[model samples]
Target: MNAVTELLAGWMPGQRWFGGKGREWADVTAEGFLLDQSDPVLSVHRVRVTYKDGATETYLVPLSWRESPVEELSSAFIGAVADPHGGENYAYDAMRDRDATVPWLTHLVAASTVGPMRFHPAGVAYIPEGLPGDILSTEQSNTSLVYGETAILKLFRRLEPGLNPDVEVHDALRQTENPHIAPLLGYVEIDNGPGEEASTVAMLQAFVPNASDGWRLATSSVRDLYAEGDLHADEVGGDFAGESERLGEATASVHRDLTRVLPTEPAERDWYRSLAEQMTSRLEAALAVVPDLAEHADGLRRLYAAVADTDEPVVRQRVHGDLHLGQVLRTASGWIVLDFEGEPARPLAARRELDTPLRDVAGMLRSFDYAARHMLVEQPGDPQRSYRAQEWAERNRQAFWAGYSAASDLQLSAGSALLRAFEADKAVYECVYEARNRPHWLMIPLSSLSRLTSLV
Candidate 1:
């Protein structure tokens, strides 16, 4: 246990999705196995690690043991362990081991019941057989595998008790036969004892074969606008306003479906003050790090104050939670929203709480701003190009809002002041996010902050 813990301490920091970075590891303990097989020697262990500051997180560590090293999978090598007979054996990340992933898919197809693990089909009449699978290299927060162009399976890395909102919402959408999303096919879950909630292990969905990611499509349009120089965004060959409008319509439809399937509540008068407090807290945190925020602090607080004073009651319901350009796909049949897991840093209970759907609208609105200015970070100081980027962003923002208002029952066109507050709060968030993660991108959100604060 100590040897493996030491190995993981060295290995975990290097993983792309590992949350704990630059933190001193206190200890690592293997909790138990989700799967244990002897023939090919595959084990999926749940391990908990405590940081130096006493923070702890759990991770799913799938490992494949082999007699000899698979030279082709050299990059996936984790470490070697001693066999009971004292002979040396090899271990690797099971997701990278094709031989190891095959059995996992087979289990899902067969609805096999292993110790403490349950595999169940969601939307299928028949199980697929003999399909090949490979891990996708998208650098996601979680790992995903595509099986013969038929289905994609997302394996959750960080484990939390209770059903994952992604799987929960996808299943609801599939039940309603919602066309704006990839259909959920099946899922794997860890079966807990009585009085304990089950944890989601993985989810499988029908893959969209030729769909383009919205981020790529949106950025490509931005590039075209830049190339056209003096031409307006509408004059550009790759104008994305129409697509943005359609995406807004799709978002409204998904939100409707989510509200229908999940629980909801009306926002109480006090809810606004609570929400404003949260926003104020975030703004103060950001201000401490980004001194430029100090200039706009007073103006931003006024916007938040308006939200607290809003008397008109609003509805709170299940939403996409983390809506952004990257979360949607541009397909032949309009747009498909993906990933309902919410912000990963927040607690699971907070993620599941009902909130105004406009929070999602705010997120997408901020994303448009990001898409506009993303390229400028690469090639800075071109005022002409920068002005064009703003034009493109404004054009799409209006189009998206128009489509959303036309399609949804929500009264966002009224500018209830809460919406503007949400937008301002989102900008404040982007400030701190950029300062910490991408300092060069700080200008984009800071620009929005200046524009927002300039408002009366």
Candidate 2:
């Protein structure tokens, strides 16, 4: 490995956006090109890592090179590399460096091409030019920069072939004028080869200022209910059922627009069997990682079997693969959905595939459960709090279902076998994820599984 590659192998694993944490690296290589030649040079590097299991992944790493170490950027500093001329040059993660962020918007405004990277504007909104961006710290799989609250740029860290689903979905929704979606301002793409499809590098969208995310709003409501000893969820001043209903309506509107623009097909009988098999396979995998999942395995398989045996008529369409409270913003006007890329860990082809909108509904239902019970993680064994949490979740879940059914004119209930199966499948995914990332939170999904599996 070269000096920079060696440094990256050490630094990249520590980053929040790095996907390969526990895996052993068999080889690591990098190639970089200069994006801007200003005072503090900005360069974007593609770091390719090959694991012992023969899996390969490429990550986009933007670094700002400086002649001397800046004390202010000590936290973002990567090890110094030997300068081509003589001495050493200090490198820092460019997303955190204010000086390095200016070139992104500048190039987008000019619609310029920097090496293989191309910036294309949608012409629907004005691109904010000459403004440095401030990075948002909440993201895990990608990094986002807010430019003067006018626009936000999401940099895709993990590089894959073809256009990203988030960009594709937003670009398709542009002409629809869907109030639930934020307008796509521009996007960045990189050339793959002579005949290969270009890969999406980043996407820019209009930023919603002074908007609170659904997670925060829902959790605050949970807190309010906890404070009131006797008040029900609906009677609480900070009840979230109304917001949940509005969010459901917004979700249905986006789903309708997606169906209008994207492809949709009637699901065949074989599709249900395939879906059940997939969920069962995922549960089997989760059992390996989380031993606690073994006890629920037989019951979970029974749920999946019910899905396979069901004869429900369904139409598959492009829906948000990953939908939860964190992926939504509660603006003054209404709820705005964000991040249609789905689960970052899943393959791109799977994320782009058409599926039932009920999957999205199931995802939201799971989110409501999470919002209600997340507070109980720390204070376990409290029956009163646990009962209140269940009450809050059920109320909001029903309200959301009512709003969705009203808007879509589809009378699907929470008791549907397919919805139950999808929710259980999502819970299984969460079990593996929480076991790997946050062990303390593993109980949240495990408890959900217990209830889901108990249902006849």
Candidate 3:
């Protein structure tokens, strides 16, 4: 390993966006191209890693080179390296370096091609050039920068062979003028080679200013309910049922637009069996990681069996693959959905596949459970608080379903076999994720499983 690769191998694993954590690296290699050669040089490198298991992955690493490090950028500094010109130079993560972020907007405005990267603007919105962007701290798999208040740029950390679903879905929805979607302003792509599709490197979208995320709003409502000892969820001043209903309507509208512009097909009997098998396979894999899941294994198998045995008519269409409270925003006008990339851990091909919209609905339902019960994680053995949390979750879930049914003309009761199976599958997925990421929070999904397995 050279100086840059060695620096990356040490720094990359500590980053929140790095996905290859816990894996043993057999080899590491990197290649770079200069994006800007001004005072503070900016360069983007593609770092490829070969793991011991023979699996390989590539990551996008943008570094800003400076003659001397500034005091303010001490935290973002990667390390010092020998310059080809014979002097030592400092390197820092470009996304967090304000001086290095200007070239991204300038390139998009000019539609320039730098090395293998191409910047394509949508030509619908004005590009905010000359503005230095600030990196958002809450992102996980991808790093995002807010260009003033006009636009937000999301850089895909992992490299894949095709267009990202976020950019693809947003481009498709542009013609619909869907009020619930944040408009796509532009995107960056890289040439993969002959006979291979171009890969999306980054995407730019209109920023929603003065908007509170759905998770924050929902949790605030839960806090309000908890404060009012005797008051019900609906009676509280911060009741979120109305907002939940509006969010449901917004989701249904997006789903309708997606179906109109994208592909849709009716599910065959074989599809049901295949879905059941997929869910069962995931459960078996999860059981190996989460031993606590063994208790729910029999009940989960029974749930998957119901999914296979049911003859419910279904139509699969392009829907939000990952829907949760954090993925939405509550602006003054209405609710706006964000991040169509689906689960970042899943393969790009699988994320693009059409599926039942109920999967999204189930995801939101599970989020409601999360928002209500998350507070109980810090305060256990409180029956009164637990009852209030369950009450809040049930009330909002019903309201969301009512709004969805009214908008789509698709009424799904809590007992709908398909809905139940989707929810159970989601909970099982949550159990595995919490076990791996947040062990203390595992009980939230485990508690939901108790209720799901008890259903007739």
Candidate 4:
């Protein structure tokens, strides 16, 4: 048991599947496990642990413990040889184990194919008929194991309480016939406890595959547009007008469905205003480092304050709370929205709050800048070519706004100022995001902020 604990504790810290930040492993307490017929060879252990980064939680780590620690095994674990008294163990990432993951995913699908939920070492798995099958990236908020072409099993990580909104909203919208989102194919609905009051700990739904994430596709478009020659922007195949309109239409359709099936109320003026204020503060805080932005700060502030104060048809209802180019997928059929789960950085309660539809629109519009600017720097050329690329980005940015506004109910009316305000606010937030993680990409939002007052 002690050898098992040491090997697992070291292995877990380096795993993408492990939830905790694995700076240093600590307090590796073995809570429980399912020992297989092959001793520790095929085993699942439940360990409660605290890390050097000050996080404490319980996690399930499956190990391929060996009778003789072999260096020939996978790098995910270190091999431990037998010492005098007992068996020595080595470490390895359980997910990399073919015997473990492949079997685990298969067992999960079989369990989901049956009556209800199945709890195996692989986590909660779900199955629906006719959906595409694949395993989603482990870096995300949940572990998704798709069963065929009809169903998706999402096993939650960083587990939360109650019915997860990703499952609930999609299911409700499916029942209401909403087309903007991927429809649900039922769920596993694990309670984690025997009582009915316990929250759903797992989910299964319709699988969406063969779709290019909008972010990547959009960046490709921007790259083509930002190429060294003026011919780049003129190329309709590279231009983004068609997709922008389709995406806008999708957003509008989603909003219309919300209006019909979901609840809406008067918009919260103070909240929008405060959020705008925060955007301003963040911009100021970041602008201090950029220095080139100080000239435009006052202008941005006035525009932001004005837009935040608009009192028009402010309706609040369910929305794709964390919409962005990254959140959408372009399919052969059309665009498919993925993951109703809100911003993972935000708390569940805050994510569930009803906000203006423009909030979503703003997230997407901000992504336009990211798409355009990210590629602008990628394309190296002479001064004239660089200027041409900047021009291309500008042209596409306008086209995107026009396409979205045409699909939406937004206008230049006094009440509709919130739309523009929110767009700027979104860009301001982007500046912070880019600064902390992608400093070279700061120009994207800076250019966007410069145009804050230009949008009618």
Give the residue spans of candidate 4 off by over 4 A: 1-75, 78-85, 88-95, 98-138, 141-143, 146-152, 186-202, 226-228, 232-234, 284-296, 379-416, 453-456
In model 1, what are the clashing residue pairs, if there are any?
Answer: none
Please give each candidate's TM-score.
Answer: 0.96, 0.97, 0.98, 0.75
**lDDT of model 1, residue 211:** 93
Candidate 3 regions with alpha-carbon error over 4 angstroms: 409-413
Models sorted by TM-score, best on top: 3, 2, 1, 4
Error of 1 at 377 (Å): 1.5
On lDDT, the leading prediction is 3
Task: Give the alpha-carbon lDDT of every model.
Answer: 0.83, 0.92, 0.93, 0.62
TM-score top scorer: 3
lDDT of 4 by residue, 337-452 (tens): 77777775566667677877778877786777666666555543346645655665556556656666666654434235676677776776676777777877777787777666
Sliding window of 10 residues with minimal summed lDDT for model 1: 123-132
Better-scoring candidate (lDDT), 1 or 4: 1
Q: Using lDDT as the measure, what is the rank order of every candidate, best first? A: 3, 2, 1, 4
* Predicted structure 2, TM vs. truth: 0.97
